[model samples]
Target: MENISLVIMEKEKDTGFLSRELGSYEVKYDTEYVSSIYASREDENLYVNMYLTVPGEFEDWKYNAILDNYDTGLYKDKALLAEEDEDSYNPGWVIKFLFLENDNEMEEKINELLGIHVSELERVLSQLKNIEDEYRD
Candidate 1:
């Protein structure tokens, strides 16, 4: 039973956006993964992973990946990414939420919101718990 799902997300860099408007770019973050990683916790009660992307940041270096910039405060010149796993490539600013539990409750909720069947969500949850366990322990 896998419950892991991958979604490309973006952050406004907090230039001048509201706190509640951070996670609003839903449609654009749902395509072509620049990079991704997952890890679990010690007791399998916690999970953590990172999402790296070069969304909208179009430069000669870092691979040119065109991301939408409709209402986002980000830009094509500046890059917004992260490096948490130290194993996979750098992740974007937006962090996908991963909770430990095999009930598929989160899956159902995401399906309700995104209207997509992501059995891979379970896969991410399990991977996160495993990776987190290594560092947490």
Candidate 2:
């Protein structure tokens, strides 16, 4: 599994229509799965959005399986998966999670969220590898 970390690039308060504190983060990962990370905190809710891109050609079933895993997993209630866009040039998946702000454990909560994402990625990679090994047999 690749080590995933969020490096905050910049953060500022937006005073526009929907006032919120916005943050841009650089996702440090060994694989090319995550492309970008953005976060916003409004009221007591902190929303984290991650853009993920899987390399090579992925079958629709495999893609749906991953989604199903997330849907039934621990993050099912907190995470929301954006609809896939097939017409985009660089097709990717956007996953958004809403976390209630706990002043004392904010950092720990963020780390836990990242750990969950890493776990999912590891699971998918393991499945893909097993399939590839079977084809070689």
Highest-TM-score candidate: 2
Candidates in order have lDDT scores of: 0.32, 0.51
Task: Indicate the residue-level lDDT of 91 in model 1.
Answer: 25
Query: Which segments of model 1 are wrong by more than 4 Å?
Result: 1-31, 42-44, 55-57, 60-91, 94-98, 108-137
lDDT, model 1:
0.32
Q: What is the lDDT of residue 126 in candidate 1?
A: 37
State residue 32's C-alpha deviation in candidate 1, in Å: 1.9
Measured on C-alpha atoms, candidate 2 has an lDDT of: 0.51
Q: lDDT tens digits, residues 9-121, model 1?
A: 32223342222211212232343333543333334333323344433432322221112111123212221222232343332333334542443553343343222212223
Q: Give per-model TM-scores.
A: 0.29, 0.45
**Candidate 2 collision pairs:** none
lDDT of 2 by residue, 1-137 (tens): 55454543222347323344343222334435556655666576566656655555655555554554442255555466453434323445566666434533544544554556666667766676545534444
